[model samples]
Target: MPPAPQAYRPATALLDLGPTFWDPVEGANFPGTIVRYRNDRAAAEVGLADLDDAEWVRHFGRFAPLPDTLPQPLALRYHGHQFRSYNPDIGDGRGFTFAQLYDRAGRLMDLGTKGSGQTPYSRFGDGRLTLKGGVREILATEMLEALNVPTSRTLSLIETGEELVRGDEPSPTRSAVLVRLSHGHIRIGTFQRLAYEQDEDGMRALVGYVLRRLYGEESDDPIRLLDHVVRRTATLAARYMAAGFVHGVLNSDNINVTGESFDYGPWRFAPSWDPNFTAAYFDQTGLYAFGRQPEAIHWDVMQLAASLRLVAESEPLIETLQTFASHYQPAIADALLWRLGVVPRGAEPDRALVQTLERALRTTAAPLDRTFFDLFGGTVPASYDAAWDGLRAALADYRPRKPSDHPYWQGEPCAMLIDEVEAIWAPIADSDDWSRLHAKVDAIRQMGEALA
Candidate 1:
């Protein structure tokens, strides 16, 4: 086994950090399926293996001397408009980006905590994450990746020992820290919050800083800074659609300006081929539903553009916004072709193949796996085919009445039948059936490779 991380922060200080999200870690709890990890080993395995003394001290102010390296949410100072209102009170709550490290695959990743503790942004609420929230996030991320959506990965989930109250369901709930690894965690909401507060200079400096850090190619071009961000944001929104994942909470705060999938609360996999699946409990208007995802993305891009408009203009920003649909349509089309059994015959936009696939699915009311595997994925290579076959057989008697039931297939959103795909992902919520589901997942993966 690898050694634990030193209970100290690195001395090397990089970015000028800001306030915290919640007040403190009042409690903690997690599911048994969570993976326990030591960050020190993970860091050392990559080139960014060590932290300077100062770095550790500044980030991990309270939770020092940890058994393993947990990312200290580099307290980012950002403001956001929640539910269409400019709420200048937002930041990382529950937890923050504990650390940034390259993983075993040589991929750059951010170690993020779900309910590590509270920070400055925890205003009035307990900065605690629920047990179900953490579990759902893990399952959501895992399945999204298997479906080819760009997303954050769950690295470790440790129960911190405590409980708290909640208005949604029950009071005195379990608490835990769910650490997620992703490409980055910065968001457009981060910029909007600052700009909304007339922090023009702050927003500009942030834009320049982000370009250098992420979009390194456009760092020097001050005038085109917002333009670059707009393009990147637009591209990501389109891609999110290709994976059939609905980021229910597309609040300015949840929009990852870094292009990485940011927050994971209230997110739901689409139930069927429909794009109107809403994940949030009270999303009566379905602002962030399945059908509105693409449009929601543009609106978010517009918000980011508006934040930049502090230095630019609405018209120019709107012009830049046009690129979203262009990029998205083609990308989704290509993605759908791969998911469906047919290739782009260059005949009729492939709607026939899509319609056929959907019609067939509705006929048998089979699991998404069976529809895609038997039809699009085929029975070859065993894994994907077997997975679908297993899933269909297991859920042979199941039915879907709502849209948030299962992981939706991205291509041709409305062309298939959906009982809310709940049954396909049923195992994730139930530990008893996880083993069977995992085996099926492995098979699904094989089929995914063929599609790729």
Candidate 2:
């Protein structure tokens, strides 16, 4: 028989960072709790898969303190630039870090809640998440992960039985609380807060805490930390391009220090490789469009470097910031190769493949996911024409990582296009039918396995 699952290992790394980083808060007294979605796969990683539905809801929905974890939720503090406009009065307005524990890999993971309740940062708005919004987050994380993007995994989503009014969606829509499993919650905005206050001591303390606890690096040098963050952030931006994903909001607060992507809002997957495609309807300026994501991410990294100037010299930070493009260009080729399930020949050939394929995608306007799916292992079918000639030549010598015999590769690629997302939500909104949603998750998993 297989070995039994290990017990939950509670951690206090965040608490050890001191009270300056967060404020203790209570979760909202939700009128009713209905388990909408629970990720058993993610729970197993954190040793919570053994819990029954009631037990799960008690901890996740009711926000009960875990056996040896946090005593109460902590609302983290930070400031971010929204659409390039600096906003000093924003933090975990509608969410709070609920608990900390070690995953099976011994890495620290946070259980952060969304739509749980309000905090000091709520401002004049209600701190609640619409049910549809929660569902979208789940779908976004799931699809992104399948495409090999390092993202926060949705742990649990529970309907809170509260009707919320919003200008974005239909008024008086159902509300829910969502819990995400993430590597860490420290954001670029976290450092910006201390920098804005001109608190040198706080800046040094925060940098030390991140290095020792999250990164496992012994040095407290902020320059080293900035370099690590820039590298990871570059790789993340490349993965987003490879996945054809548009994270509508790329605010500093939304970008985590760990380089893991989280906080999904108004996100969309591309139907075709259109550089001008924007996810948010309000993004009239196309500031965070699909093609501009790398630039946006680079800007966020620069802000991070700027914050580090409190503890480090401006020269090294500038040098570190300049390395983003160098890391990003190569990372894009690697990420695309992973998605295409091909073996790399060399840097020159791989980059040529990426460049040629991009040109073909832009000119042909072929379906983004489908094009990658069809060309898996560099196999170009006879249906190709002159538009694909450049891409075919570039990929001629490459070989597939594995055989494309998976049943999923035989049919239409599993995609989360906007229309498909709405189609999945329509049933839940109209008749509470969730079969389609569950089926999509299952299909997405199959695709992930095939890619793996």
Candidate 3:
């Protein structure tokens, strides 16, 4: 008998890069397999929308390899700096890349897991994800995508019947395993690992692989790769700021070559334009605060440049690192304009509008998300105070891109503040009611359509 034809095309591209980049491993046998969430929209993009609930759990929960994708999962190896301290002992501690395939657009995508089980990199810690943690990631990625931020889609989240002890949250929480749809699993830490070993050949091979596979280019020049990554990271940081988001941990390992945001942990959305607001409770120093995201990302890019120096020249990499500011400033302006539903004017005028808006936000007590909602489409409300004068002037000649007639525009703007997040979780924790979570996702999707 022959195997049945699958709907999606599978590829073993990562295996082609050879065994140095990753180690093959097996997934855990969970006691329970209950599908908590399924991303049908993202599934449609990958031709998996036809999968029934049973099939979804069989593939995602049991970690079964899709048809011809991967015979076994791969635990990727990498190292990164955590809180400015170098640590070479870190890698995929709780997850592995399960499968790879081309999306409908013919773009290569990876099905990576979180809390799927232990690996060589577990480092004396249990490889488990809290159910609450998985819920937070789902909310973060959905809200970010609705805000037009480039992020890895949360494909599936399945609750595993287990009790887990942890120090961060209340101990003995429920466990879960998450599947993420991402462009690639290769991180800056991937390059750093090669550089730390003084394996110049490995670094060279990795650069070629990244360019050929993820970037769709044919260049081995490490400097060129660094430049591309710097620009993309800059734009990513700017979008984070414009969206009033604080990615609590800006570790190099958390950032990937594709510049898409993934691996959510202790992330938060800013209520107002406060620079000192931090996300992670342990980040008492505010190193990755709401305002310092650009600086943190710039420092990460510098680390990448230093890693690339193992194979490339010094001056060009240094020069490429310096371009972060040039890319970031314009990107934030454009991102803010897009959120406000206004068309772009020239660079200088758009910048002025952003600066004025920031200044106004600082002087008032209004939440940043609400401020954006009120002044959407360049309309300065008559109810606004004198603090909005500068912003009103800045937007005087600008016209809105579209009328604020989307049904969502009439009511309050959707906000993922901590209080709201907790409110949504309370029902599920108490009685397994998921109505609020479902409703929130629907509202965020509507907002995305309106913004588009």
Q: How big is the positional error of residue 80 in model 3, measured in Å on the Cα after superposition?
A: 0.4
Whose TM-score is greatest here?
2
The Cα local distance difference test for each model comes to 0.55, 0.91, 0.90
How should the candidates be ordered by lDDT, best one leading? 2, 3, 1
Give candidate 1 regions above 4 Å deviation: 1-73, 102-108, 218-235, 313-315, 341-367, 377-452
- Tell me the tens digit of each residue's lDDT in model 3 across 20-78: 88989888999999999999888877778889999999999997778888889999999
lDDT of 2 by residue, 1-452 (tens): 53456568998888877898899999999999999999998888888989999999999999999888888899999998899999999999999998888887777899999998889889986888999999999899999989999999999999999999998788889999999999999999999999999989989888888888778888789998998899999999999999999999999989998899999999999888898999999999999999999999999988999888888999999998999999998999999999889998788988888898889889999998888899988877779888898877788788989999999898888999999999999999999998998999999999998998
Candidate 2, residue 341: Cα displacement in angstroms equals 1.1
Worst 10 residues of 2 by lDDT: 1-10
Per-model TM-score, in order, reads: 0.70, 0.98, 0.97
- Model 2 earns a TM-score of 0.98
Better of 1 and 3 by lDDT: 3
Off by over 4 Å in 3: 1-7
**Model 3: per-residue Cα lDDT at residue 307:** 95
Which RMSD values do the candidates have, in order? 9.4, 1.3, 3.2
